[model samples]
Target: MDVRFRYSDHLVGLIEDAAVAATRIATAPVSSLAAEALRAKRDAGRLSARLDASPLDDATADAVDAGSWARPAEERWLDEAAGEGWLGEPAGRRLDEALGGRVTGEPAGDAAAAQPADGWATALKLDGMPTQQVAAVEYANLLACYDAESELTDQLFEAPMTVLTTLHGLICRGLVAAEILGRPRRTIQAVHDGAQGRVIFNTPDPRVVPRLLDGLVDWLGATGPAGSAGLPTLVVAGVVHERLLEWQPFEAGNGRLARAAARLVLRARGLDPAAVAVPERTLAADPGGYHNEVAATVHRRGDLGPWLEW
Candidate 1:
């Protein structure tokens, strides 16, 4: 039976904090601090922070970080996606049209219509899903991330700005791939067992994704947002992002899917959908760290904590 009715309203404030934190960190300049020092400084922990003993405080650090996070280090791909602003227009208009339609399950009102009309629109849909259907060991995988958050907001908390609903209800648009839209990858499996998998870098097999996500959904459904032992929203989002990438559910577009989910969680939790502070920017900048941490989750410890910290 479904056990998603037990969620809490506390996630709202937690998510808001995370969204703000992600946005601020994403926009910051490359810190001159040593790598470890940088990590220590950015983490929200106070005791851990005292170890660094830097004069930097949260607000000042944010200003300093955002002020120069991109001025140094890899300056090349910083605005890469910014150029692709291609999706901006299409996503906005779709938000408007869908809202205008006011479909019960879709976004509505002036906010949807307010999205900027000037954007280089691009078609966002899935065409040829593999002709051979990958039979579901189970189909609950379809709702994967969305279902998790949707239940949190709708079943447990207020119905507004949920996983399925968001700024302008824009989430109504093509938030994910077409064929596999919101499901977990039944075909994706871990490349190896936790033991050997750690020694080598085999991309996780997609086969087990469905089972893993199903278990995850069940856990979230049963216990609710308070279930993760009171993990911060951003940490939770980070775990979701890292695990999804490792799962690589879709035959294609896994990265986009993962980042989309991350962005949504941030927005759903109150990151100001209009804000450009996406964690993807941070990961994109630190690919090495991203890869290593993600690897550690499945490989080294099979624990998501490391990835969340990353």
Candidate 2:
């Protein structure tokens, strides 16, 4: 990826509010949407490269051009690519072995024994990594991640709570850890307190997650009508994003869930309804900036200005 501006650069120096920026983007000329499709393909390629997966091919790009996203053929190609991305070649091999030495038809939680490492390089190529299996549920999860994008366009416009439920539900749909699937810890829990514990960078306490989430969602118009904030959809998406990250409602898939949730806000508001912005690639392209800004924003007061600027 080319060098891009940091979160603080404010390189565009747009003085408009997030709302205006969103409108400007949403109303972009139809001619430009073709270009947008191209960029989306480019982004998918970057994301695949970052994840040590194969780049999406020209036909996949043509799929986007033909509006085949979330379609069966598109899903088969893209979802499998995403599955490959989530589990690089090595982890895929480990998972392949654990799936009774194949990639398909494994039982759920079969790879429950595999403990993904802590932090960003969780399952990329490394020597003698412990997690060496793919559970049936994890395979379900891979398929679900691709399938959910199709659902987002319709659901993102529903009630905020509905949207919230959808986000968690999607993340939980094919969870490898059957234990934590669709359930938030009722008792107190900490990311750093378990055998899987590692510095999560930052996450609110389990006790406070509900409270903070309640407050944030209400402000976000989740329980009420959305777009009440009057902010640009982009800004709203950013806020939804940061709040989801800070709250960390789920034991796993929080980052993936948050990214999808943010995209939901955009899709609901017609900012990126085609699901082509590929913000995940943006973050993947600059993991350092993402980590730094996520820490900086949450550590201080709930100021979203810096992240929005980025």
Each model's backbone clash number: 23, 3
lDDT of 1 by residue, 1-310 (tens): 1112112345445556665666665565545223433343234222112221222345534543354322222222212322322124444344323334221222122122211211101122323422111111001121222323323332322221122222212221232323222333334222222324443244543445445554444443433554432555565456556655675543333444455456555545554233234354456465555656666665654665445545
lDDT of 2 by residue, 1-310 (tens): 0111234436234424444655666677877876775566445433532332223344544444455533323112223433543234654354334323323211123122322323223212223322211122222332355445555455444445444544454344433233343334333323331224455355654545555545554575543344335555666677777766656665565655676677767777776665556776668766556656767776656667777776
Backbone clash pairs in model 1 (N, Cα, C under 3 Å; residues 3+ apart or in different chains), count: 23
Question: Residue 47's C-alpha lDDT in candidate 2?
Answer: 51
Alpha-carbon shift of residue 117 in model 2 (angstroms)? 14
| Candidate 1 ranges with C-alpha deviation above 4 Å | 1-183, 186-200, 203-205, 222-226, 271-274
TM-score of each: 0.41, 0.55
lDDT for model 2: 0.48
Alpha-carbon RMSD, candidate 2: 11.7
Native-to-model Cα distance after best TM-score fit, residue 283 in candidate 2, in Å: 0.8
